[model samples]
Target: MALCPISLSLPTLQYFYSEMRGVDQENEVNRILGAFKLNPYEQLGLRFDCDASALRRQYRRSSLMVHPDKCPHPRAKDAFEILGAALKHLEDPERKSNLDNALSFAKEELLKDWRKATKHDAGVRLAASLDARGMEGVEAAHVATPAFAEAWKARSREVLGRAEWRRRRMSKRIKEEEERGREEHRLEKQLNKNIVEHEKAWEKGRTERVGTWRDFVAKKAKKSKGGPVGGIKPPKRLRALLRCYQQLSKARLSLLVTATASAGYVAGSREQIDWVGLGWTTLGTFMAASCANTLNQVYEISNDALMKRTAARPLPSGRLSRPHALAFAAIAGVGGIWILAGKTNALAAELGAANIALYAGVYTPLKVLSVANTWVGAVVGAVPPLMGWAAAAGSLDLGALILALGVYFWQMPHFMALAWLWRADYAAGGYRMLSLVDPAGLRTARVAFRNSCYLFPLGLAAAWLGVTSPYFAYESGIVTGGLMLCAAKFVSSRSTANARLLLYSSLVYLPCFMLAFLAHRKPNDVDDRLELVMGHLRSLGLFRSGVDREDEGEEREEDQGRVAAGTSGSDGAQSIAPTPGASRPLPPLSPPILTGDFWAGPMVGGLPPRGAKS
Candidate 1:
């Protein structure tokens, strides 16, 4: 047998080695896919304590084994990518340090657990006794035992699992915080960009704005020289007076206030209409409103100059001086209170004074301070109707309260719509309105809608309280229902079109509702109603009896005898002679005496005397 072993061919050995390498790559891909995903060290099959070079070498080996081109496994690509990511994580100094700390902490916990168990376990104690005689430390020798080694492995895995979970949580939290910071920074950058663009645009238009203002001034100057007024040029004094009127008050709003006062007076009147009283009440209310409005413009001059809607106002446009405006307000205020106190009652005068103070003192300053100023403004709007009622009735009664509350509630939807439509202007003017704060308009819409709903019940309450007939409720329901629908549409769309629709609806609703109320007004006299009640009670024998009834019968007989004697005279004529001891019938009731230009009208026939024939 001296022929010896035959030499293997090099190509055959290379082919076999290639087959083995392919099988090894497939196996590594499976192992990587099966490893714990949270821990990068576990995925790469590298120890947590491994240095950057060692980690890099292991990652390279693992990645090559699971490379998609080399491995036949379907998940080879995923394993290769995962191995690359693990290498990147371990390469970072901070990440590597955190992992090392986690591993050290896990090892320390495992040793502590082991020592605690060994204190009670006989087998672990025997292992520790043997370690006492050996060169290794007792804890290390104990960990070398099969039982302690199994426990240490489990405890280390558990501790590393907790550490990985904490790291994932921390990473998620940090990412969220970074995202929030980036969003805030982006918004700030956009805001600054917008401000710069706005300033640039304003600067570009400066020359045009100045030219337009000059043209306006020239036109005004020409008008003062001699311009067409009501188809004919007026005298200088007349023009100046008209200009003063325009500067002192808003005519349309003042007229609306006077109309509301007239409505309240008519509603509250229980007897024949007091047209003279109505005139005085309306005039006084208008003057007070004008005073308040002028004071408001005076206070908000600087703020008004910023808003496009208010920039052309008298005070802001420099058409009216502050001192002149103040003087006008003072005269209007004093004159208004004087008229109310002298022509109307003291209560109406006090209410007028208080309303002026509320509007100019409290509401004006509060406009820039709080969103609640809108509600305070509603209260100011309410006082006019109450003043009218007090002027006619000489007291604040339940009917007056209902009328005032209607005005109060109506203003919410009306002004809320206006506020929403002019939110940008309000913001520019530095006023704190609800619409300005509620960017989405949810709150403003809710407020408007809620107040509109209140109108429905208020109408019913007015009828229930005998302020108006039941028919007014039906009419008011239809009107307020439309307002509510408009409000709801605004809430749904939050668009300018919907808000404008709501505003128009509110404007229509007030006039229609007031008209309906006036049409269905219950105008029964208080004295007549009270007399009827007393007569009914007496008929039921609840009031008078015996001697009182006899005295009433004798008085009735005596009145009948006098009437018969007067009628039975030779001529069929009315008697004008006064009885010696009989008290004369009370004179016809009339309105309080008027001074100055006003004169009391003759008393119109009302209900007949209490016991007289109809």
Candidate 2:
């Protein structure tokens, strides 16, 4: 769409709107005014002095498309009214400038009111007073402190109320202007009808050339000469700079994932890790994960371009060519494997390579086919910690396997929370996150809570039996697990805001508890290896060496039987409620899109449109 030749002149436009919405369209002056509204003074070909009937016909056609009823919105009630008013103002030369002046003046008055109203904010006032002495331990003067505080509080309310009132007043004024615009539009409709009839009459009589010198000049001015033969233009140096920036961003993401994964490796090995080997394993895992992320992006470029949020990303936006992305992927992938093989044990390097291949080559595509992709993604996500442990321990042992399981189990809740926040984006991009499909959020919340619940005993057992640390297990069980349980309880609220709070809680809980375990040390606490292994097994819910798969299955049934038997005939036995927020799943932060007010949910309003929109 070419921008109108006329200046934006919102103030003038505001004036025109007030005069447009009349029901009458037969007046000559009204038809001319409608033409002016349709084509402003700066338009190259359109003339204000045209015969009225021809212009009237043209505007009537346009009104159909611009009518409020045709283009629906939440606030369609006043759309046509505003358009009519603009037409009305333009139809009359006398009041066009008057309309502009009133609008300009009204805007200024409202802004002034707004400024005065927001001059005192409670948070700011409280902060100032507290900071004057000290917020940490406020020790301000005690001279009539209560009275002063009370006065301040009252004044703050007054100011805040004034601000709110001013905002409402501004909205009302805007609505009023729309009404005036409707009357103007009605007037313009008349002028248009007259201009169009005049044009028809002229055309009826003409059997020969009828081009005016003005028409010829207007036609010449509209043409733009162009020369093109489909030759491609190379990206400018600045474009190249932007490409580098995107690569760096991807690199930065890789570095962080690697570093965090490395931390786990180091932390995992404190019990039985070889320090030198662990360092090598960290080197390999970091490179491998980074390589995989690059590959995943390269593969998903087509899908990314279809998502609003992802469309502007490097590969999808054509910032970097496919070959370039491919080359980067290979370099990262090959270099990462090399690092792992050279620095860590062969087993660590091999596992790292396998994970990368599985994630990028297999699971990445699985996202489109199955929601079980979450499980696949988790398995891939869990590989890094094991890579770390293997880097230190040189191979997978029972303890390392248990530790890996913990990571696999932890990912569901963490990613589900993220999926809730980005549900729209996932749905828009056609990425299969559980939260996207479950609008009720019941299944998402249940799975999230259940996964967290199961982790409690496993985490404690990992610490107690010496798979990790006893202190870490107890702390994880009592504190982190309890916090998750509380967050789970809140997931059944009617507002996505509560779900959003739970999502935040979940994100916080994982990292904090993981760090807590890493920070604990329990070396040499027990002398006998046999006794230590036995303790670990018992904590893990294993009775003895004789226990097999069948026995373990039976034990689980018996435990469930106890729980079921105890809860029999009781409605309160259920651990969690359904759809905490009524029907809508969790949202992110605050400010729900459906609600006028701001609150948080898992996936809030900021994500891209649905998957079908390019």
Candidate 3:
């Protein structure tokens, strides 16, 4: 008690103070790690309604106490980061406002419960308690009684629990929505990828598909020879005949030619169709087409051997000798010409001969020399229809010309698609096709699209020329429009898939277009049929015969007056009076007969039966 004080050096004092600071930091780190992490105010040990400056001051003091450089705690970095995050959250205006509102709501609910329990407002009690204690802080625990402090803590816990649940639910819902959007986007991308892969695979397997088709054809030919027929082996003679048949003709193409020839015959005839004559016409057309095809094979044998698609042909495969093929062509040509001349007419025979020569001589030779062979081939396809028209009507007319033009225009798109599809084969065969010359397929697709456009007008022309009804125009328009759309797709993207689509559409378009023409063909004997029906109706007393006779007499008088007036003209040409039983011309069939409002007889002023009431 009586000893003198000993002073320490300045560095020792500084070191002692550093040791105390380090201990305080370690303790602060432990407290920060132990605090509740969800609530910023709880994590920072601050009241809800603290001002921004006080929040910053408290955050800095807490951060220094838990600084990782000074603290010796294992979780010092984690604690420091947590403390910094808490400070940031409290500084946010929206976050601070929400916290303040939550705390006030919790205090209000506590006061209500207190009033119900003690029969007095907790606010008044809290104020009186605070005045008595003389507390300067805004914290409820600093001024409130112990009972109020416990109630406030319970209410705050309940409010914080509900708020945490709502926040988690909102976060989960947002994640679910985001996951659903990603799944939909992934599915759409996968679908697009699959489509592209399918198209690529289809194009890549084109040669394999062609080979398979050729194999199938060869197998069918073998079956026809001696393999099996309906599970029974064919006789040797029958097999020999089948082999000769295969060697002599391309069956599908010949049948198509015959069918087109028959269509032309049907379209041209204004009188009753001669079924016997049609049979002869089909036979002659088939022979003529076979002759052309056989001769073409004979000339292209070497080239055909070089190509995949044509290598399996009889001439190229050596299934038929050149001399035998030449002899077959000769026989077919002579036989076809003779039959046409004997059964039909000179014009039909002449057309048959010309087509054979054009196809075998012009088109076949031009195939290797120039791309104009396609046009020549189209002309060759066009001749059969003319031959049929000649066989039926014994002459060519506008209707015949229209039918031939249809065949001509149709061949362009049909052959262009086929040529583009087999461009590699054509190039290997040394044929100078449009597709071969235009490797990018630009001109080939352009040619196809342009020809498709021509088909629309050709349909309208048929209707305009009175060869078919207006219904045919509408029907053909739809069919050709579809073809045009396919061709346009090929033009835009020269893919094998699109080219194949155009080819299929062309195949369907031809048959449909021909059938529409036949279905809507304007009957030449409509007036005759109408007169015969009217005469029968008069015989049955449905119309008065005396009235019809009177009308005919008046018409004769008017005709005679016109003839007399004509004889008095400066040209002095006398007009003949109409015959007594001659039928009046029928009007064009514009509207469909299936409609309720259609009246065929009234269209040509033939209704009311001359004297019947309207």
Largest lDDT belongs to which candidate? 3
Error of 1 at 263 (Å): 1.3
Which model, 1 or 2, shows the larger TM-score? 1
Candidate 2 residue lDDT tens string, 256-323: 45655665576555446566665666556666776787788888875675566767777765567678
Against the true structure, whose TM-score is highest?
1
Task: Using TM-score, rank the candidates from best to worst.
Answer: 1, 3, 2
Stretches > 4 Å off in candidate 1: 1-234, 524-614
Collision count for each candidate, in order: 0, 75, 0
TM-score of each: 0.58, 0.46, 0.49
Off by over 4 Å in 2: 1-256, 268-279, 523-531, 535-614
> Which stretch of 10 consecutive residues in model 3 shows the poorest summed lDDT?
595-604
Worst 10 residues of 1 by lDDT: 594-603
Distance from true location, Cα of 113 in model 2, Å: 82
RMSD of each: 18.1, 31.0, 22.3
Q: Alpha carbon lDDT of residue 298, candidate 2?
A: 83
Q: Write the per-residue lDDT of candidate 1 for residues 1-614, one digit (tens) a residue.
A: 43333344666778999999988887788888887665688788865555778877887788778888878889999998888887777778998777667667777787776567666777756665677554247666555666754554456578778876888999998997787677546544654565565567767988988899898777766666544632334576578766766766877887787788888889888758888888988889889889998998899876776778777776766566789899988988899899999999999899999999999999999998899999999999888888888888887766777778888999998899899998767766677889866767899999998988887788887766666778988888888888899988988888899989999988898789779988888874555433444344444434332333345456667778878788889987885444655643322222222212212222125322233333
